[model samples]
Target: MRTKQDWEWLAAGSEYLAAVAVRELLQEGKSMEAYEGLAFLIESMGKSKKLALRSQLIRLMSHIIKWKCQPERRSSSWAITIDSARTEIEEIQEEVPILNRDYIESVWDKCFVRALREAQMEMGKKKCQIAALDWAEVFEEEYWFEED
Candidate 1:
């Protein structure tokens, strides 16, 4: 099985190729074309990173909501899901160091909104009033579980 590190290397290679394409276009004096390629590459990278982070965030949020709304229904599986999401998010941040606190802050609310919708759907609730948890709470390992 390909490990996470292997996937990260592939992502890095893809980014490098995009950067090289932009650089070559600039050297050819194709300023407009270069700008277009560069912009597209940058936007594509940002969106990919955001989507990855958002998915993990949603998983974490959904589990937290489930844990809170139905404390009795909590299981080791829910805890594992939360832990796995946190680990994946950390790995993503390590790979793309630019996805720092500021980037998280910019995207957190939007992700949380989507997460809430997802949690409601998954939990079969008409409404889930759980507030967005703190960043540390969501990302910290073992934050929700007494034992994992």
Candidate 2:
């Protein structure tokens, strides 16, 4: 009596419910069903991980856009955020090896557009122009507070 809702739990990040469902299937000797459920769970978790990675990328890019647009108002807090997002993105990639640079590049344009809009709204500017971001500058460049 499997329905779409059975998979919805996994998609919604309900790992406990998913585990219980799989256990029940296994106990009933429905090995094939249990294996399929596990496969779906893996795919759902990968999507979740990739979404989190995208969020971090957007946050990092938005901060970089702000940093570029308003250089005069730079703060150490912003730098820390940028660093933290970069680290988290890297960690996600490490944890999920399938999500590599190609995946990041694939979503880069969409993430940049979201980031641009977010940065513009946050800056309270009705019209703020942000040039295209360089991949190396955004991910590779080090941003730090200068010693005064």
Candidate 3:
């Protein structure tokens, strides 16, 4: 039987990681502090450094990481703490005076990658004659071809 627990934790991790990566990309040009897994968690989730954003990122990150977090928990890539995630999210939500194309491009790329990940999962789970979902990070560079 396919227990919910089997896919729950991994799915949560993947979702949060993808979201964080996208949020970081969105805030990349705005703040220098967000270069490495979000700076602090006081204000926002991304690079905003505002208390308001920090709070939200913390909440989202905490929800993603869940209660199973070990005391010295460490992901291969630095795990953005619940606090930091909130701060990062806030930074991304901030309005910039003008449109920054480069930053926008980065965010779009991240979002594209995320969407592909989600699509891959859906494509993998089929009723008749299941197939392997080869959506590993290795082929992340491939452009997604959609029928429209």
lDDT of each: 0.76, 0.87, 0.35
Name the weakest run of 10 consecutive residues (lDDT summed) in model 1.
Answer: 1-10
> Which ranking of candidates, highest TM-score first?
2, 1, 3
Q: After superposing candidate 2 on the true structure, give the runs of residues whose Cα lies further than 4 Å from its correct spot.
A: 10-13
lDDT of 1 by residue, 1-148 (tens): 2234543443356877767766876888877766666666666687688789878887888788787788878888898898888888888899888888888888789888887888888888988778777776776636445554
* Error at 93, model 3, angstroms: 5.3
Question: For every candidate structure, what is the RMSD over all alpha carbons to the true structure, in angstroms?
Answer: 8.5, 1.7, 20.9
Full-model lDDT, candidate 1: 0.76
The local lDDT score (0 to 100) that residue 138 gets in candidate 3 is 18
Local accuracy of candidate 3 as per-residue lDDT tens digits, 1-148: 2233422332344545534553665566633333322322211232332333334433433323221223233342323443344345535555532223344334434444443444335344223121222222211222222332
Better of 1 and 2 by TM-score: 2
Q: Which should have the higher TM-score, number 2 or number 3?
A: 2
Scored against the true structure, residue 29 in model 2 reaches a CA lDDT of 98
Model 3 stretches with alpha carbons more than 4 Å out: 1-45, 48-99, 125-148
Winning candidate number (lDDT): 2
lDDT of 1 at 139: 67
RMSD of 3: 20.9
- Cα displacement (angstroms), candidate 3, residue 50, comes to 12
Q: What's the true lDDT of residue 35 in model 1?
A: 69
